[model samples]
Target: MAIDWKGVFPAVTTKFGEDDQLDFPLFEKNLQFQLDAGVNGIILGGTLGESSVLSLEEKGTLVKFAVEKVAGKVPVILNIAEGATRDAIELARLAEEWGAKGLMMLPPMRYKSDHRETVEYFRATAKSTSLPIMIYNNPVDYKIEVTLEMFAELADLENIQAVKESTRDLTNVTRMRNLFGDRFKILCGVDTIAMEQLLMGADGWVAGLVCAFPAETVAIYKLTKTGRLAEALEIYRWFMPLLELDIHPKLVQYIKLAEERAGVGSEAVRAPRLTLIGEERERLISLIDGAIAKRPVLPEYHSIVV
Candidate 1:
């Protein structure tokens, strides 16, 4: 199936309870909310979803739940980014069987410097399933960059259909667009750089902040595509302050907190991950409130909980 890899695809948050257990019910509610808000797809287990912290079982359950809840309304792309090729392949196969539309694999973090090792890791994982694979190339998180040459090599693999170019490099996005032509789809992975990337010829955006403000993100994307830059910039300015949170170390926590403020989900997160609290929490709330105040009217789907 040719997935329409466009519009707002939110890197969803994994809701947790006070006991640090996955809140499946809350997760489903959150998923439903994003879909209702008109997201094109749901990216489960991505960085924003805190994929690294989830156990294999938790990953499987969440993928299954997201697929079931979406029910053909939107594509569910599972992040099968394991440190080893074997585990990634296994998870890829599992996700395919669980009804995921595609797989998003990141570079193996174990071998930081070897580009060949990273290439082999992705090749082996792609070989395990026929599902289309989207490379998650975020050098900031992985510490290893997938160069244009490496991306060119991966593009030859039939199932390697798309890339989530997280590095905020417009030149590289243009290079990929030049090299691959239409063979590979490039989706902007950085929320703050999305409009520029799109203008530079990126096919779609895999946004994290869209979890809180799907309507605006989707609007910006659509408007830019239609050459409505002046109107889009108006929304972009309001989004810029909130987009700053995407660069923070505790982004997942911040996004979940924003979701809570928007009444979409809880702010609770698993251990090793801390929720925003005290003055820091107050600052975030104020920022969000300020963003809300600047807008003439909030998206109809959003309701302020605090």
Candidate 2:
């Protein structure tokens, strides 16, 4: 099946309550906020959603909830990454059954292994799920770098339809585009380099900032797609600092804080992940406030809360 892997898809935040439990209502509200702003799709249970911290049952609940809330209005891609391949496959199956539009899988973390193991992990996932799979290439977080050759091999699988290219290498991005071309879609995973990736021939973007700023993200993609380099570059410059927050180790905290400050979502995060505090929190807030102040106002639906 051909998938429309264009436009902005946010790794939507999983909102939590004061008790540190999943706030399904707030989570649904957050999803509605994105859809209302005209996002192409919603990505659930990804890194930004604190997928690692959620239990199997919780993950299932979250995916199911997202599917129901979206109600066929948008595509929902569930992140199915776990310490074990079996667990990941289980989640993938559940996601598909629950009506997720697609799946995003990352290499198994925790135990470092060889290229063969990485290839097997993804291959097994592709075999298990009929849903369109997007390889989430984030070597920095997973400690497993999938070589281009491995990606090419996996691209042969019919279900393996796209890749969320998080490897910050422009050369690799160019090479992937050359090798895969239109056969496998390439979506930008790094927010800071999204404009560069799209201009360089990426299909779309799986962005974290889109959780709080979908309209701007979509605008950026539309601007770049039409060859408005000057306008796109100007927006990129204003948005770059906010995107830079993802480079920090405490990215989830930074993103949630941005959402909270902007009135998009709660600042609450599950334990193992904590809310930003003291100097660090203040610094992030100050930086975002400044960005909001200096950046030009976007169009109606493109307005971000500040």
Candidate 3:
């Protein structure tokens, strides 16, 4: 289950029951649904996965569950979003012990670390485990940008191999390619700009809305990779409205609601992040319903592989 670091990797949301417990059946069903749609990897405990609210033991359970359910068919990556360096290192080590094939790591969770601290944090964590790491570089949200110089400093760390490119500057993709060659595999993190990033030489997408619209997301990626630009754009235009939902502050609730409406997921979110209500709910429902009512016919994309 080596991570080639290509294709659609969904930042899947953690499913929950009315009782607020982890709903294993629902989780597995959605996970299997994503896999069946031809996604390349599964990312557990990411922002969408509610990593902040999950207990240490809960995170371990998810890794074990995803690993077992995925059955080594694809790489299951556990996201480590710890605030402390020591804790991040411990979690990285535990991920390997729990059978995680790879890791997607964010910078120090609550604190906005400076360049040196950020590099050190990633350096220390990546050095801790044998698991291949995809550095989550979303400065817009996480507030810590892994600058090119910082990446160069970490270049010698073989385990810190790939990046979830969320800087929102698409040209940074070319910058990385020009600077390091392929030393770092780049996966587009923003759903809205995915096709653009892919068209510009991104290796893959660490997608958000794909949690709900798995098949469409994969279709876009496969279509682009296969050079079916016209077909890809057709779907991408239709998917744009849905993809915009991923950038909101309440992205978890927004995407979960999309999932619920799509009949592949539920709307139950953890506390401090309640489900959408009022105009927000109405607006999203209308959007999701309209998209479903007008769901585009996907051309056969399975033949095209990345």
Candidate 4:
């Protein structure tokens, strides 16, 4: 399947069992919600999905299950965040073999590579896979910014097609549009800045909080892209407080909490990362509860299938 690489693609959360195994049934339940909400694509094992803690076998199971369950309704994309170029390449091949239609790849983990090295890493991964890649450019959390210069070096790699622009510099959207033009498709990566980025010409959204609020997320993107700023802002205003959670250190737990509140999934996180507790738990619950209390009756929003 040729990925359109445009529209809201949720970086879905990985649901886990009591033993911390891949909770396939619960995971599929969340995926069905995204698909029914009309997400353009589904990203498995990204930051929101807790890719770092998952074993290769667990990830493979997720890829195969999502590929089978999604059954081509939309492309199933696996995230690649390996620490080495060779490992990334190996996983890219494995993703293809596991029936993924595309990949959302990050730069080397732990070691922040320089510009030249970053370019080489992306290029090598691109070389190793026939599947299209969306470069995850999240300098905020990852500490490795895939700047325009690095992108220029990677311009010729035909398969290196899109960027999940999460630099948090709003001007970078305009900068990317001006510099790269259509050389790369731009998917807005930050949740809070998503509407602004779309207004600035992002082709899609690689969303985080959308895992919990799929309908509202789709509504905002659809409204913004169609020039309904007033309507979009109305929903955005209601969504802003919850959207802020996506930028926090414990976003996975926060989002999963929101998911449970939204009646989609469990707040069960893996070891070393417990569900929200104490004041932190109350704080998040307050945000989700407040939003739900005054939630907007969203306007009609069908996926803009490109």
User: Compared to the true structure, candidate 4 yields what TM-score?
Assistant: 0.98
Q: What is the lDDT of candidate 1?
A: 0.83
lDDT of 2 by residue, 1-306 (tens): 235877778998888899888898888878888888778788888889898788878877888888888888888898877778897788788888887889888888788868898899999988998898888988877778888889877877999888898988867778987777788788899998899899888878899877776667877887787776777777788888999887788888898888887777888988877788899889999998888778666644344221
Residue 54, model 3, lDDT: 95
How well is each residue in 98-200 modelled by candidate 1, as lDDT tens digits? 8899888888856685878888888888877898888888998778888888876777689998889987787988888778788888899998899999889
Give a tens-digit lDDT track for model 4, residues 1-306.
999988899999999888778788888899999988889999999988888888999999999999999998999999999999999999999999999999998999999899889999999889988999999999889999998999999999999999999999999989988998998999999998999999989999999889888999998888888888899999999899999999999999999999999988889998788888899899889889889999999877784433
**Which of the numbered candidates is closest to the native, going by highest lDDT?**
3
Model 4 residue runs over 4 Å out of place are 303-306
Give all candidate RMSDs, comma-separated.
3.8, 3.0, 0.8, 1.2
lDDT of 3 by residue, 172-232 (tens): 9999999999999999999989999999899999999899889999999999988999999
TM-score of each: 0.94, 0.94, 0.99, 0.98
Better of 1 and 4 by TM-score: 4
List the global CA lDDT of all models: 0.83, 0.83, 0.93, 0.91
Give the RMSD in angstroms, all C-alphas superposed, for model 3.
0.8
Ranking according to lDDT, highest score first: 3, 4, 1, 2
Candidate 4 residue pairs in clash (backbone atoms < 3 Å): none
Runs of candidate 1 exceeding 4 Å displacement = 296-306
